[model samples]
Structures are given as C-alpha cells and as structure tokens.
Target chain A: MSDFPLLEREMNGKPLIYLDNAATTQKPLAVLQSMEQYYRTHNANVHRGVYQIAAEATDLYEAARGKAAAFLQAKGAENIVFTRGTTDGINLVAQGYLASRLQPGDRILLTVAEHHSNLVPWQRVAKQRGAVLRFLPLRPDGTLDLDVAAREITPRTKLIAVAHISNVLGTIHPIRALADLAHAAGAAVVVDAAQSVPHMPVDVQALDCDFLAFSGHKAYGPTGIGILYGKKDLLAQTEPVQYGGEMIDSVELYDSTWKPAPWKFEAGTPPIAEAVGLGAALDFLTELGMDTVHERVQDVTRYAYEKLTQLAGVTLYGPGLNQTRGGLISFNVGSVHPHDVATVLDACGVAVRAGHHCTQPLMRWLGVHATVRASFGVYNTRDDVDVLVQGIQRVQEVFLP
Target chain B: MTPNLSDLYRQVILDHSQHPRNFGSLDGAVAVALKNPACGDEVTLFLDVADGVIQRAAFEGHGCSISMASASMLTELILRRPLEEALHLNREFRRLLQTGQADDPDALGDLEVLVGVKQFPARIKCALLSWNALEQAIEGIDGTGGNPP
Candidate 1:
C-alpha cells in the first residue's frame, strides 16, 4: 500500500529519496487530515471555551494528550504536558524542576554526545545554580560508557539527563540501566527521547525514568508541538516556569494558586491543532505497530551502513552493523566537505543533513568539523539506500576525481 | 544525469577548491574569522595591507567546495587592488550572487562562476562566506586607521 504520498514526488527529475528523517519525518496523510479536520470542524480555543466548539477543541487537545501518555506508557494523561518541542520540554524540566533543587556542590550528569538542546539548558542551569555540569564520556565505538557513567553519578548528582539515542551517533543508549543507576544515586533521570520515541517503543514505566521529553514533528506529527512526561509526584512538587492565563486556578494581584501538574505546566493557549495531529500520528504508528516500524528501519539502516562501508574513502561513525542502532549513519567521505557532499546528493534527488548535527561537543570529540548524515524513516526502502550509495559515488567522482 | 551538477560544481571551482590559492596564514597580517553558524562553514581571512592597497591576502579554513573556492578566488582577485576597490568588489560580487545578474561584469571576473549559486538560495551563504570575511576585515582595518596592532 502507498502509505507515503510524499515519496511519489520528484526532485531534479529524479524520485525524491528523503533520508533526513532524523531531522523531521514527513507527515503521513493521516496526520495532515487530522489537523485539517480539526481546523475545518473543531476550530476553537481550548480549555476555557464555554461554547460547544471550544469544548470539542478542548476534548481533542486533551485526547491527544491521553494518546501521547498511552504512547509513552505513562501513568495517566496528567503526566503529559505539551510544549513547543524537545527543546522546550527539556527547558521546562531544567528551569522548573532541577534549578530549584540543585545546590552548589550538586552535579547534573549528562553524556558528551547530547544534542545542544539537551546540553545548553543544563549548562545555563548549572551556571545559575552553581551546580557542576559533568559529562559521561563515550566509548571508542561511539556508545555511552555506562561503566564511566556509573562511576561519575554519585550522591551529589541531583539530576541525570541524557539522550535515549544519540542524534549524531545513532547509538541507542541503555536508558533503563542508566535510570536505575541514577535512582540508586538519589538522582532524578531525564530522557531526551526526541530521537528514540519516533523509531522504537519507549515505555516510561519500563524505563523507570523520572522525566521523558520528545518532539511530535520528529515522530511524523506536526511541528510546534511536543510532550514532556514527568512522574506525578515529581511534577506536583515541581513549579511551572511559565505563568499566564489558563494555567492558574486562582490569581490574586500579589499571590496565585496554580492548577495541577500538566495543566500548570501548559501556560497560555497550547498548540491545539498540532496536538490533534500528533494524536493521529500516534494512531497511525499504533495501527502499523511500532515493532514493525522499528524492524523496517533497522533493515534500511543496516543496508545503508553495509553499502557505505564497502565504499572507498568513507569513514563511518557509531555502532557496528550487527549492533543495535538507530536508523541513521553519520560518515565522512575522503576530504570532501559534508556540505559539498549534500549538495551533490541533492542534485541526485536525495535529501540528507550535512553539518554538526547540533552536537558540537560530539563533533569535537569525533575529531571532525562536520559529517554527512543519511537517516531513515518508515517510508524508506532498500531502493533508497541503493540511490544514496550511487549519490555518494557521484560525490567522490566530483571531489576526488 | 542533468548538467546541474556541472553548473554548480564547475571544473574551475573544483580546481580552486582542491588546490586553493593563498591558502595559508600571512605573516603580520590583520586577520578576521567569519563563520556560518548554520552550516559550520568557517573562514579566517588574513590581509597584508600597506598604504591603502592589499599587499597579500590569504585564508585558512574548511568548508564546502563553493565556499573554499570562493575564498581562494577572492584572495586572487583582491590582491594589489586598493582597499576601497576591494570593498567595492565585495559589494559587487554579493550583488551579482544575490541578483544573479552580472550588472558589473568588469568588477567580478572569476567570481562570476558563482552566478549559479543564485539558483540555490541555501548555497548563497557558502558562496558569500569569504567576501563577508573580507568586508569585515577591511572594516576592521579601516576603523583602526588602515593599520591595526
């Protein structure tokens, strides 16, 4: 069945082989239709509309939250709070939850390979709170050295934030084990699920993480919406960073009383349509089965990895082909710059991301300025990999010829 | 494949990128580094100016073929030209790339190869990196009375 209508389109008179899914997934028709239907039928402000349309809008928005909660296997809908994206979600936890609890001697432990979104907030929080920001070094294979992590995380570590999957390395982190380690050290664990949530099954309960953050657009949903799932007791104790209309129970001139966990976190009119579209995205993934999607992605990634390895002058990063990894590969070809590689690939109608991938620390760690990354989504096939391999060959010919 | 590849990565641009001219630091030169934060394309331009004329121009950095080649060609074109003329050349080259029209062909000789960059809006910044650095370097030097310590 033709699930992806976008794949049918052509670029430069060639079929579009979109391999930049790690940046953002192309939305399926279901997501588009869901958002369209919401705008067409239930177009109203959420939470406070006494009118029927407003109530429907509120219902759809909340229903999306519930679906997101179920998707992450959280305790209930109240555990889910909507934000702009993964960056916003992490900022909420960093500013609202961790900042108040951290002391001068406390440490915020994170991996060296975290996206700038995950790393910068903690840097700011640490600077403000006098907390020490510590990094868990990566192994030679680009996977997290959990042994080093276990050694670094101590009683003084109040919060441990790490990406569930490296956006650059494509190595899936051992979140459950890391969470267990953090909890034993009296540290609350926060999972940056922006890369993991879309490609695999991420059960919050199974992982036992205190907080998890993900963006909807990365998982085939609309932009400008994401979810932050925190534990009920933790969120209840944590104060909201943003204070405005619709989030307070009672507002006095000098003092104010706020609503419960999720609502208190959501200030102002949230992304109602985007949430509805994310709900539809969850439904689409659920029907297709996350396991099926994960397996398909693994196959495509493996194919691309193997194909890239065989090519001369190509240096691949991250885990081995046999090892479990996310559906992407970051690599460099000879001395050709990634921007030039991506431009040549674009000429051949292949879309890829070429830059630091927002992991500048990791880029420095990797000893390269930048690398070309070809990532996969569910719509990708072996044929796409074949085309990408051919495109890389073309890049080599142009640059290395 | 269509000829768009050749249109973008012309052989001359490739030659310059592969073996960039004046591709090192100059001794006792006033240097300024410019970076395209979006793509991590960085260029550190070094200029040896004496008596309002560019004595030597060189750069050292890593970027795409377009950017590296543009930097190489920029140094070659601006060398021995007066400071004002070099700044004027920077403006004319930017205009040509932005408008895709060689309004002043005599001013932009080798830089005209970058006219194809106008077709790719995203690549325009890559083409402009060196010129941007040159502009900043000239302004820095001029602001310091054409001689900076």
Candidate 2:
C-alpha cells in the first residue's frame, strides 16, 4: 500500500479511494525515481552522440524496448515500435500499413464495442479507400457474438480489428479464435490490447495477432509512451508514416533510404525518460508476477460486482458473476445520471469515472447515454470496495430520496 | 450531508430538476442544439423573439440535476426579457461559475443557488450547458440573421 504514495492523500475530508484505474493507474515510487534518475544522470539524445552519457541514454532507451518486447512475448525489440499511445499506434497501422493495401470494395471488420480510438482511424481509412466497414454485434450481456463474426469475416475482408478486452464492458474476446478466423479469410488481425495488457498476461505470439497496441500510462508508467508490436514481416513491408532524423539509413540528393522496421517507425528523438519509466514499471510488475496481479484485481472486481448487485435499482452492464470479466464494472443507479452519482461519490472520497468513457457507440447500443465505471488495480482491496459501497449508499440517500 | 453538498443540491434544485420549467418545443421558435461532447449531455434551446424582446423561451434535454435544473431556471429568468438583458444575465451566470462571485446576487434570483457550483469545477460545464446554447442562439441571430420570422 505504501508503494503507491498517492493513496495516502485525501479527497474532501476522507481518504481517497482511487477506483479510476481504467482511465490511468497511479504510478509507484520506482517508476517516478527511474524517470528522475534518467534526467539527473543520463539526459542526452539517444542514438546520436558518441559521448558516454549519450551512449548510456541510448542503451536505456533500447533496453526499454527489449523489456517491452519480452513483456508481450514478441520476437525481439525489432518487433516493438515505441508509439505515443494506443491511439497513435492504431493510427499508424491504419495509415502506414492499411492505407496502401486497401482497395475499393474491400471490407474492414470491427466490433461495436471498440473505443473511439480504434473505430475512428479505421473509419477514415475506409472512407478514403472507398472500402466498406462491417460491424460484429455483441451479445445481450456485451460479449462479442462469435456467430456474427463468422459471417462477417469473408474473402472481401481486408482487415479485422478488435479489442482484446472491451474497455466499457470488460468482456474478454476470444482473440486467438478470431485470429484463426481472420487467417483463414486472408485478412490481417489488429488487437487493441490497451485494456488487456495492463491487467493480464498478453502473449502476442499465442494470440497470433498481426499487430498489437497498448499504452504505458495505464500500466502505472509515465504518459506519452506506448508500444505497438507487429509481426516482423508485416512491419518490414509497411512504410514509415513520419520521416526525419534517426530513422533514415542514408540521405541522397533525390532519394533517401529509410531504416528497417521499428527504427523507421520511430522517426525522431523518442520519449527517452518515459521509456525508462515504462521499463521500471514492467520490472515492478514482473517482480509482483502478472498472474498474482491479475488474481488480486479479479478478486476485488468480483467482490465489487457482488456488492453492487445486492443494491436495488443498480444495473450492472456486461457478464454476470459466473462469467469471466476483466478488472472493472460499469453500472448506473436508477434514474440518476452518472454525473450526479460521480459528484456525490466524490464528496464521499471515492473516485470513479463517469460519462461515455470514449465508447459512444457502445453506449447507444446498450440504450444508455453514459455510465459510471469503477475499475480495480493491483493495489485495490476489499476495504476500498466497502468504502465505494458506502459512498453509493450516500448517493441513493441524496438523489433517490 | 455536508453543508457544501447541501448548498450544492438544495431543495429548490431538486424541485426544478424534477419539474423543469418551459420544457418541450415552442412552435415557430428558433432552435439551437448544443452538446457537451465530453459527457454527451445535450440541450436544444428554443426561443421566440418578437420586436427585440424574448417573447418565449423553452428547452428540451437530458442531463444530471445540475444541468437540467440550470436549463429550467434559465428559461424562467430569460422569458419576456429583452435580448440584451438575457445575454447580460447569461454573462453574469458565467462569471459566477468562473469566479465564486456574481456581479449582482439579487439579479440572479433563484439562479443564485447555483452559485455554489463554483466549488465543483467539473460540474461547472453541466451548469453552463444551456447557458452556452443560449449564447450560440443569440449570436446566430445577431451576426448574420434577423429576428424570428
């Protein structure tokens, strides 16, 4: 508990019960120190200078890439491209990889449960290429309808993009099965692992996804840095979206040759300090063991779901207790807006996210405009859920009265 | 409830949220739709202007108590007032949300209760949603348009 120093703070007059883990996790002391140490000792442009500090800085940056590659069980650092975040990574794939390959009348398969980050990029590419967008529907409980997926993925389908776990519903999709389906149809698979990588073990090779993306901020590291893992062959074939310093192999008067794969994608001075912080975050989680972390969060989330269910007028979205879910729950109190609920809960020192949560289409499909989400992390405990329950009870006393 | 919470959600606020004034569409009224893209809170304001005075004002929307109650109270204060006066009140209301103090407390009337919204920064958008729509409606009329036909 002391590892995360922010938990000691107060909201209103009470101890803060931080449950907005889905939005971003609170950083630990190790990550903070790692970033500070980088600036204090080894602040230099990476892969540029021959000086000692520059060499060490470059080493730290590349080492972070190695850590990220191992974290996702990719082939090597060559398979990992450091990106701004999940949105930037997905946009890279959309513009750099898919833009040239897409032909008129080709189809891109997606699910209705995707975050806007995953949906909007593909929408623009489809529009530009005169391609059609096909959607896979969700079950009543918010799980992906595999039957519909079978019908949607045809020979015309050029790409299949889906989230490994729905950020709104916490429904873990069958990515491996979907990959097999896409492979049979000759369509590439792109998995938005932003919500999955932070909470569970994610092996891109096991999933056999062509491309995978996740953000470091959600995994208790600094913002502005993320990883986009693509198969070595696919990355080699794709062109660099942005070109400049560091990424060029040779510069000529008329034509410049660009570097291979991940370096070509990086383009400029990368996020060095943020990469160091992310590496430290991965080390911190590795020390804890991902399986242990996942178990703790799942237990806490299940306890919260149980407690929330017992309350009358509470409508929980996604699967019930028997079914597996990620470390979050979305629900709404009867006739009470999520904004009001969030405000009242804030006064009681509970922090939860409220609103569309960047999933407006999913909200519309669920016949709701918005929802309140309470998400868990490795640091959350049963006592925090108790405080959240009390806060919600206070909300009922105020709004439902 | 704490005094701050009580001050934020007074009985008057609850009443107005439950029964918003001047709700529904006004026939032959100029309409403007506004959405707080962050939260999906929406407001469609309708105004009937006759000879530089606001003859009628109504709104239709769904949001939290603060936003809905603010919309209801806005229609009550702006109806039958000159366009300039309504715009002045809107400015004063925005000032109250921006800073803790309103220029003239008495000028706000029942809307003065919303002055407590200054404490909660996030809810300030909710309280100002309809007011923003009101501004856009007037600006649309004053810039390139004339009075309601």
Candidate 3:
C-alpha cells in the first residue's frame, strides 16, 4: 500500500516512516485529485448562485453531505451538520444544545482519558450552566471502569460525553454500552469519535448515540471540514449558536427567521472544497473497505506492540497486545525523555508523536509527563514497524549507554 | 540516512545531563518554575542572591538531555556572578542560539558548546528552558526586591 506518493519521499535521506496517523492521516491521490478537480472546474459559492457552475458547486457540496450521512449510517443528510472539526462540533453541542437544557445541579459525565478538545468544552459549559463536571474513572490498565461508570451515571447526569477511542492510551471505550446506560438515565450521549471514526466502523444507529462528532483531516480528508451527527429531532430542538447570511430563511431590521437543522448550524459560506475532499476520502475508504483498512492497521499496531515490548527498558502504555486497541501504542524508553526519544527517532526518519497527546489528566494518571506514540495508518507495513523498532533501539544506545 | 547525533548530543552535554550539577533546591532562595507545556519539560530554578550577587544557583526538574544539561550549565556558570552579569549572560546566550553564532568563546566559555543546537530549531527550546527559568526567577527577584516571599 505504498501507493501513497508521500511514502515514496525521503526524510533526512531515509524513506519517511510516518507513524503519527493519530495526529492526521496522509491523504491519498484520489482525495487530493478530487479537491483539485472541484477548484479547477466547479469553483463557485454554494447555494447562493443561480448560474450553472454555482448549481454544480451546490450539488457537489450537498452530495458530500449525503455521502457523509451514509458514511456514518445516520438517518439522512438532515442529520449531518458540517463544522470546522471535532472541536467545533463539540462546541456546537455544548453551546447550542446543552447550554439551555443544563440546570444548576446537572452533571456532565466524561471519562478521565478524553482529549482536551473533549474535556475543556464541557468544563466551560458546566461552569456556564452551573452544572457539575464529573469523571468516570479508568482501570489500572487504562481501560474505562464500566462498574464505576454504571454507578456514576445517575439521573442527575444531563449529558455523557466520552471519546470512542482514547487518543493517548489507544484503548477503545465501550461506547454502545455507555450510550445504553446514559439513555436509560434520560441523558444524551455525545461521542468524540475523532479517533474512532477514521480507524473503525462507526454506525451511529448501532452505537445508539444521541450525537457523534468526527474530523475529516484525521480520516485522510482535508482540514476545515468535520461532521456532527445528531438525531433529527434533537437537532430541530437545539438552537443554532451562529447567525448570518446562508442560515437565514427571512430577515427584518430587528427580527429574523431561520432555515432548518444543518444549514442553520452552518453559518456563512461553508468549506466547499474541503467538503468535496472529505466525500472523496470517504469514497476511497469505501472502495478499500473499512474492515480491510482496520485490519491492516491492527496488524501493524500488533507488530509494533510486540516489538517494543520485547526491548528492555521500554514501558508500554494502554492495553496488552491480546486485548482490543486502536492502531497505536504509547511508550517510553528507560529514563529517556519522550522528546529526546522522538528526536532520535526523527533522525532515522521515523516520525512519532511525543507529547501529552492533549490528554494531560490521563498523562498525570499514567504517572508520566509525556509519552512517545507510534500510531499506524492503512498505508503502514511491517517494514515501517521494523524501522521504528530500530530507531528506538538507537535512542536507547544514545541515551542509556 | 541517520542524522549526525554527536553534533546535537555531545559527550559533554550527555555527561552533564547524566550527572547534573547542583541538582537540588536552594534553601531561602528565590525560586521560579518553568514548564514547556507542549513537551511537558519542567525546571524549577532556585537562586540565592545576596546584595546583588548570586551566592548560589541550583535547579531540580525532569526533562530531556538538552534541558537538563542546559539547567546544569546555567547553575554552574551563574554562581558568584553579580545578578546583572547573570541576567546579561542569559540574554547573550539566547542571542547566540537564535543567531547560530559561537564567536564569543572568551565570554561564553563552556556554554559555547550549545552553539551546535542552532541547527536543530526544535531542540533550541529544550536548550533554553533553564535560561527561561533563570530569567523568570530574576524578574521575580526584581519585582519583589529580593524578598521572594
């Protein structure tokens, strides 16, 4: 699968071994070409122009919405609202949906392993609405403690926001079960599927989540485009947080009416080229099959996990190789700092993420300041893992010896 | 295709990182903690200044070799120097790193070894963490008139 043109290029003279897919995936030629085609042929403002080119632009943009809806297995295009990214999507729910529904004593439940994007928004909303922010604890191995989740999610919980996959730990959370429990308590379930959607099969209906959010860039699509999937009824009830030209139905000097659902949320001219790119990305994944893509990554991750564990002085985080995990592994070598480890790896043309992964609380919980994460994508191969293993050994030789 | 490791992680830098000098808190000293939030590198610098002179300097933290070695070097170089000279050296060292110059060997002494860090832009922050902490501590002293409490 080295068909990706970027993989053929050299970094620091060596072929680049990109193991930072959790940060963002490398776009395929199809995704890039589709985006280029949109700008070169159908370059026009969507939904506003009556001309032929504008009509084609509008059709392509709306068709992207349809593709996104089908990709997530949502009800229809009405359920999919475009946002900047996962952060924007969550902020929409926090401000537009939950802001009014939240009461003074209501609880917003989240797990300890959530990325800052998922955690900080709730903190702001909770503070705004006088709602209490609570956490569902994790087990020793970094998996969520469902028993604690069962007890903590009480009737007072207004919303249960959690990551479908822990970005730092790479452990997949039990979203469907959590959604069921939250639904039983009359609380809406909002999933930060930023990591999960790109790596696995995510059917909103199957998970039974009230709302789901994911980014396009992380799924081998372009930035500035993401999807927020909400139940049609819930979206209709929630107020739009933004107001401007495209979202309006009718306007007066002091009074105005609004369009319905998705359009109402997407204010101003949307990211037309970016939405087209995401549609092409989804199409590419569909052709390859998500299951095949998932299995490919899992194979690479398992190989990396096994290799890293065998090396002395390497402490691996998250679940064991035998357990279920997303396509990543966070680790540290001896007393070598993660930044230094990453630097040494970069010298050998291996790019890994070495930071808190935006999960500082989880870092504190893990008793580490930071970790070096090697995340796999569909294009990764066993040879990439071998190079990563060798690079890590070089780090050990440099720092330890 | 491997990068030249010796240029970045020199023997002296590695040795200083492994056996850091004055790696402890100074009692009754002005202290300030600095953190590189992106990488989680942290250093708490404590300076015992007496009548415009740095009587002692020490630090304690967990970070990479560049940061730890830079902190160790900072403590070693600032001891017994007047507060003004210490502050000046901090600025001079930063300028050297930013400009990638090593001309002032007589003044910079052993600190000149850090000139190699100029090539690696990302590692420059690691090499400057302790100096930042020292600058903050000095500013704290200036603001409080040496009575850090």
Candidate 4:
C-alpha cells in the first residue's frame, strides 16, 4: 500500500488480537503493497493481451507461476497450475484423473482425518465410478493409524488421497512414506497440503506425491488463488476438468484440441491479481525463512498446549503435546460449547475459529460437533497465546458455574 | 471501547441459562430438535397443545447462555399464549432481534435480557434456536433431518 497509506486499529481499547491464522492469515504490508502496485500501475488482462500494460501484467502473472513452481521446488512452471484454492485443485484431479482411470471394484483409500473439501470430492467421484471408498483409520489422539493405512492399501487400491497435515488434528503425516506405499501398490497419491504448506517447508518432488494442493489465503496472500503441483506426465495425461478460453490449442467448428499441462488445466482467465499476491507472499516468507516460521509456530503451540490444559475443564485435541504439528490447536473447554467459547473469547477481544473447520468427519471422529481453533503464524507472538489462555479460562468460569 | 461482558451476561440471564425452567419431556407431546450444527448447540422443544392452545411448553437440551436463557424465557411466555399468538411472538422476536423495537418490552420482561444478543449477530442463532424448534413443532415439522420436512 505505498501509493495508498495503510491503517491499523486497536481493540478492547488496545491492539487487535489476531489468532485466526489457520482460517486465513493477515497479509503483510509488503504483500498488500505489491497488489496495490500491480492494480494501480499495471492493470490489464494477461496472456491474451498485446498492449504495454497487458505485457507488464503478463510478465508479473507468468513470473508468479514460475515463482510458485520454484517455491514448491517443482522442476518446471509447466507442472504448476493455478486453481481457485486447495479444494478446487483437488476437485480438478479427482474429476480429471479418477473419472477417467478408477473404475468398478477399484478402491480409493483416504484417511478419516481429511477436511470435507479433501474427503468429499474423492468420495463423490468414487461412488460415481462404482469404486469402493475406504478410510485408513485414526488413533485416539487423532493421528492416522499407519498400520491401518498399510492394511487398507491393498491391491484393489487404485488411488490414495490424504492430508499432509490435518486441519483439525494438526498432525503432520508421513506423506512421502504414503506416496511410496501407494506407488508400490501401483496407485497414485494426492496430498492435501492446505494445512502444511503455510506452516512448514514443502518440496513436492522430494515428497514424491503425484499431486499436491494448497491455498494462497492460508499462506498470507489474497484469496481465490491456489497452487496445484502435479507430476508432469500425470498432468499431461489427465483431461482438463474445466473447459474455457486460453486452454485450447486450436478450435474448429467440428472439434478442438487442448493445450498442454499447466495452461490446459488453468481454464478461463485465472486469478491474475491474486496469483501475483501469492508470489509476493512467497517472497516475503522466503525472506523471513519458512524454517523459522515453522519453529516459531511449534514453540508457541507447545506453550499454549501445556498452559491451556492447566485451566480446569480444559480439553485438548490433535497431535501429542510433544509431537510436531502444524501451528494450531483445536480444543474445547469444559462442557462449554465451541460457539460459547468463541463468543466469550470475542467479548475479551481475542479471536478464534469455532466450527467443524470444514472437517466434519474429523469432528464426528472426535465425538464433537465442533471445536474452537487457535492457530499461530509468523506475525503472532506468545502474548496472543496468553490472551487465548486467559480468555478460555474466563469462558470456563462463565459456563461451568 | 471494550464492551461490558456483564451487559451480555446479566445475572438473571445466567441464572435462567444455568437452571432453565420447564425443562423436560412431556411424553406424546410434539417435539422438534433444532441444533446450530455450526456450534453443536442443540435443544429439543416439547410442545404440549390442547384445543389449539399451547397448553404448556418445555425444552430439554444444552447450549450457550444466550441459547439456553432464551429457551427458558421462551417456555415461560409461550405457555399461556395461543397457537397464533406464539407464531406472532416468533415474528416479533425475528423483528426485535434486528431492531430493538418491541411495543410490549415489559410483556417480555426479563426476556429482554436477550435484546443485547442483537449486538452479536453470530450468537443470534443461539438465542433463536429454541424458538425455531417451537415454530416447527407447532406446524408439524422437524428441523433436523430424519423424516421428511
């Protein structure tokens, strides 16, 4: 916002407490300015434009695709496709690949801890293709039961889709191990990295997954922009789920030929401005260092987990107190409903997410309709946790009595 | 400025939420289970109807303060009102929730403890979940899925 000066406000007659990072992170000033600069000075459609502004916008847009590819450590930008978000990306692969390949009697393996976005699309496609959908069980503490996953990944399994880090549980899975196992079984794997990408460093090639999906909003960027990193051969072989302009090689009265890999998958105009914002976010993260971000989140989550349980009636879920997890904790206090917990916290000017968090199956597995989530980001401090703990205690006092 | 917590959590309101009145099943009475699935707040409102009048009303479930307190207050007023009056009360609630205009705020009395719930739009559902269930029960409908609408 260089051209447009930014503004900040206080809450509770104090500085605003923002702890809702897992839901959507607040973009840094740099990200905001990059977006403002692009819109103000170089506002134009990309790829199909011929004017000076169009070329400039195209450079920024294509540069963003290249940057996203580099961030994900993919070999080429062609393997990176722009999607609406993680949900859209996974839905693309499900419709494009599963519909064409998976058939009757084929088994599609998924973990019980997946978000509804990740779980539902595969289930819908599997049922339509007459495939049997199976779950790779979960542990009491909410981590996936790897032994159960092994047993479930049988010869009939044609595809496997699992979350890299569960949105509800916050447990980071052995994605590479799962990918190797799926490949050994002659099945492809799709990794839902929506939770992991924001909190940890990711390299899709090293992870060896067929496809990986994550959203921009969670990664300190604008919404409606996401990255889908698919292996080159697989992306080429799969059909485009969405048909529109910029995706066709040539069109005739009788028939049309589709483009290759990334562009073929990215139908319509794509999220141009939002994609630029994502690129800027990635650069900002790189400057701060993902390792440091992950470390900071881990430090804060562990602190909150230890201290939060000290309050009476406080309950915690997700990875173990010591187990490495994404930067959030989802839990409930006493018999206080999550909505009540959230409302009371809001009254104290502390924000937290309260709902199924789009992981309803995980909610059912945990035997609760919803849980309040407090997630940390690079911008968050230990003071935020103090506020959360203090606020939660207040909720218990209000509800328990 | 920090909003006063006491404004939302009055003692009388908290009392009603903690020890809700007329809270049990009246067997063979029409019931509707309405839940704000977003927050796991559930309440099953039991309607005891006789001669097209709401003879007695009761609620049995758990939720937030606004939710439980409103249900307790709802049972108290809905008991003596006729079927049409209860429907009208529902309309007034739907309106007063948006604009604190009530021709008979004293008629509502301590039930007006719910008026401040209007300030928090998200919690409005908590205050109205029971009333919605009551509406469904009177009209021969079940809010949650099981049988058809």
Root-mean-square deviation of Cα positions for candidate 4 versus the true structure, in angstroms: 3.3
For model 4, the superposed segments whose C-alpha errors exceed 4 Å read A1-7, B24-27, B60-62, B139-149
lDDT digits (tens) for residues A173-254 of candidate 3: 9989998889899999999999888988889999999999999999999999999999999999889999998999999999
Report the candidate with higher DockQ, 1 versus 4: 1
Interface RMSD of 3: 2.1
Weakest 10 consecutive residues, lDDT, candidate 4 chain A? A1-10
Highest lDDT: which candidate? 2
**Model 2 docking grade:** medium
DockQ leaderboard ranking = 3, 1, 2, 4
Please, what are the lDDT tens digits per residue for candidate 2 over residues A73-105?
A: 998999999999999999999999999999999
| Clashing residue pairs for model 1 | none
Per-residue accuracy of model 4 over B87-143 as CA lDDT, tens digit each: 878877877777867766666767777777777778888888998897788777223
Query: Residue A292, candidate 4: how far off, in angstroms?
Result: 1.2
- Minimum summed lDDT over a 10-residue window in model 2 chain B is located at B140-149
DockQ scores for all predicted structures: 0.63, 0.59, 0.72, 0.56
For model 4, how does the per-residue alpha-carbon lDDT over A79-124 read when each residue is reduced to its tens digit?
Answer: 8999999999999999997788887989998988888888899989
Which CAPRI quality tier does the interface of model 3 achieve?
A: medium
Model 1 regions lying over 4 Å from their true place: B1-3
- Which candidate achieves the best DockQ against the true structure? 3
- The DockQ for candidate 4, computed on C-alphas, is 0.56
lDDT of candidate 3 at residue B28, scale 0 to 100: 91
Pairs with backbone N, CA or C atoms under 3 Å apart (clashes), candidate 4: A1-A33
Model 3, residue B91: distance off in Å is 3.1
Q: Which regions in candidate 2 have their CA more than 4 angstroms from the true location?
A: B1-3, B143-146
